[model samples]
Target: MFVVSAPSGAGKTSLCRELIDSIPDLRQSISFTTRNIRDGEQDGVDYFFTQTDSFQRMIAEQLLAEYAEVHGNYYGTSLETLNTAEAEGVDLLLDIDCQGAAQLKKNYRRGVFIFILPPDFAELKKRLYNRGTDHEDVIQRRLENAEQELLQAPWYDYLVINDDFQSAKKKLMAIITAERCRMSRTTYLLNNFTVKGDK
Candidate 1:
């Protein structure tokens, strides 16, 4: 499993989408949220939009793998989603916030945690404004939250500096591919390739 966390407007969503499109067996984990569904967003595609009461029910039932309240709305990843991915032996990608990422780390220690960073604060602000999706106050709030989010980068396993889209994508792909090639994950591939005939 892979957990990616970034402040808003860091292009993490685009990067995750591209990664899923490029990789054959990777699947993105759909999260449930109590926030309003934005325009052009499908209920199950972008997020599982639900009411606050429903989210509370989910929490009470222990149905969520990890959840957090961000900007006054609750967002959570269902345990069922991760279970399905593991059952199918497919790699899963989670586009989550810093709080969600931290909770996921506690529960899924083996997951590859990545922090996506914008080139700098100025670039981040530019991207936020260019998107033109939020109100002036909302944008400012996001920027302020971003500073605190960036501070948590050191807690992650890897950092992808999103200076350029292509370069950032390459770094993300490298991280995933490299993790797949690790001895721990590839032990089965080398099981029968020992120095058998060299004795």
Candidate 2:
């Protein structure tokens, strides 16, 4: 499992999208959201859009592995989704906010956690405006929230500075591949060979 978090407009989602396309074995765990779908987003592909009441029911039923309220809307990752992926021996990439990431970190200590950052605040502001997806006031709010979000980056296991899209994507893929080859995860390979009698 891998968990990724970044402030609004930091390109984490775009990076994760590319990573999914490049890695066939990895799957994105689509989150459930109470927010309205954006222009290019699909129902289940982008998010499982649901009513606030329905999201509340999920919270009450303890069906979500981790959830948080951001910009007045609720977003959650279902426990069922995580369990199913694990049962099938699949890798899952979770795109979530800091709050959800914190909860996941505590519960899934072994999962790789990464934080993405823009080259600087000015670039982040430029990207947000260029995207043209939010109002000026909303962008301001996100900028304010981003300051706080950046403070949470140090605790993450890896930090990917997204100065260039392709470089960042390559680094992200490298992180996943490196983690898969960690000694702890690969020590079982030693069991395949018997010790030779060298005297």
Q: Report every candidate's CA lDDT.
A: 0.93, 0.93
lDDT of 2 by residue, 35-89 (tens): 9999999999999999999999999999999999987899999999999999998
Q: Cα deviation in Å at residue 25, candidate 1? A: 1.1
lDDT of 1 by residue, 95-143 (tens): 9998889988988877999999898899999999999989999999999
> Which segments of candidate 2 are over 4 A away from where they belong?
195-199
Clashing residue pairs found in predicted model 2: none
lDDT of model 2, residue 131: 96
Model 1 residue runs over 4 Å out of place are 194-199
Give TM per candidate.
0.95, 0.94
Q: Which pairs clash in the backbone of model 1?
A: none
